[model samples]
Target: MESTQVHTLNLTSVLSVSKKIILTRYWHFVSLSILLFFPLSFSLINISSIIHLFTDDHSNNHKLLITYLLIVYILALCAIGAISYSTHHDFFGEPVKFFDSLKSLTFSFLPITSTAIIAHVIICLISLTFILLVGTILMLVHNLGFVVIDYNSVYFMWFLVIMGVILIAIVLYFYVEWSLAFVVVVVESKWGFAALMRSSYLVKGMRSVSLLVMLYFWGCGVLIVLICSTNMHAIVITTLGSFFFTMFLLRITAANTVLYNYCKALHGELELEVGEGFVHEYMNIPSEN
Candidate 1:
């Protein structure tokens, strides 16, 4: 009975276990590299966006925003891939090199990363379209310009607002569930939408925990940056703010990678080693420490 109880207690939630792994010195160095590399990468990527922002044509600002998003999204995927790949190396007690992780972005990683970014952009467009539809209906109703029946329009506006909130909530949940797709892409060498499908599969029954972990880290990072922005010097704020934000990203990536492994373990899928390529044959599942 005591042994059974011990076995049950050993199966702690992945978040709790992963928190320990992410904080270790081995992973911290990899995360630090990511934190340092991000700003330099962002500056290079932002050149075109800054040029667009300063252009005389304010009417094309929407197009500029889309262009900026495309640039940022592509760079963000590469950064994520680099960081997550490095963490995977350290997780398995392998010798981790920065360039090796960057090189690991080949195979299914880049394609899946591109696909995930495109999918996110699509989701944003769909959400924007819904918002526009709501605005259009409101406009048409107002143009009808009913005086006595204006109360009906007001009520309908409230309903639309509520619907907008609900739609946002649903999208948030969907995003959370699919958040680990990149990790799956790297680990399993899955291509394109297939990686997303694998991520959706692995995230089953874990959405609440995933959402909470993300919010906790991101909220803390935002709060720290906000405080620094208010009270610190510009240089201090820029340096320290970026540090905290990068740390948050690093930790989140690590935790999600750990979660991915745990889910694969649960499903009896073979675990990929740090330097191992994807193989079809299932190996015996190892006991988790």
Candidate 2:
């Protein structure tokens, strides 16, 4: 929870980022609140099943499970956009109803979210390829007697482990660098890959700040995983874990949206489109039947 203080666009530290996450009166936006609450409820109802899916590796539906997870991830991104948009709107003095945010999300935001997800997936695949290539070369060099290093040595094993960590860190760096694409799409109404390019551009020169925020999210995720792993059978713990995880995710979304707006302001590109939500509402207003 954040103390009640007016926030500024100058995000110079993690404390500033935390303020963005904590200061939002997200509960005031009823529609967005309901959208967030659904995840908690769903988690509670399906906690046992979800636990089984991960803990019981004997389940043979790997393809189906992967497909389901992908769909869920995309939907979660879209939801994040909606929640963040609502938060951003409030910050810009244009507080909007949930329906307005939902309208924007369904009509425009989904494609942007999908594109960002696809771009991220492609990047991960590339990173994995690079890691594999390096490993293969190392193995080949050892196998062909071109190097004196033994494959089974502790030092060689540590070298491979260190290389894997370095590769993961490189991937995480880009992940943070492009973290704001979803918010960029919702705020600027950017389409397809444009959102991604915009995110990269806005995040330029601020990768360190973005990385700090990313680390907080990573920490939250690690905490949730640890809690879930240890308390799988404790219903109360599981429920609270789901609730906190959902809140942590929403907080990250809020932080990203704030960071995006700040970057825009820094570059003199903070065009928030006042009443954009109102325009959505007008368009969504149905004729009397």
What CA RMSD would you report for each candidate? 6.8, 8.8
For candidate 2, write residues 99-140 as lDDT tens digits: 777777775566676767677687879787988889798878
TM of each candidate vs. truth: 0.69, 0.76
Tens digits of per-residue lDDT, candidate 1, 1-289, equal: 1222212222234445455555555454444445444553333324344455656476555666557656665656766676667666555555466567767767645676676766678689878887888778767777887523354577767886798897888788777868788887777677567777778898776666668777777677667656655644465655666566666666677777766765555554534441365321111222245
Q: Which stretches of model 1 miss by more than 4 angstroms?
A: 1-16, 26-37, 40-73, 132-161, 231-233, 270-289
Error of 2 at 273 (Å): 7.8
Cα lDDT computed for each candidate against the true fold: 0.61, 0.64
lDDT, residue 214, model 2:
79
Off by over 4 Å in 2: 1-24, 28-71, 271-289
Error at 128, model 2, angstroms: 2.7
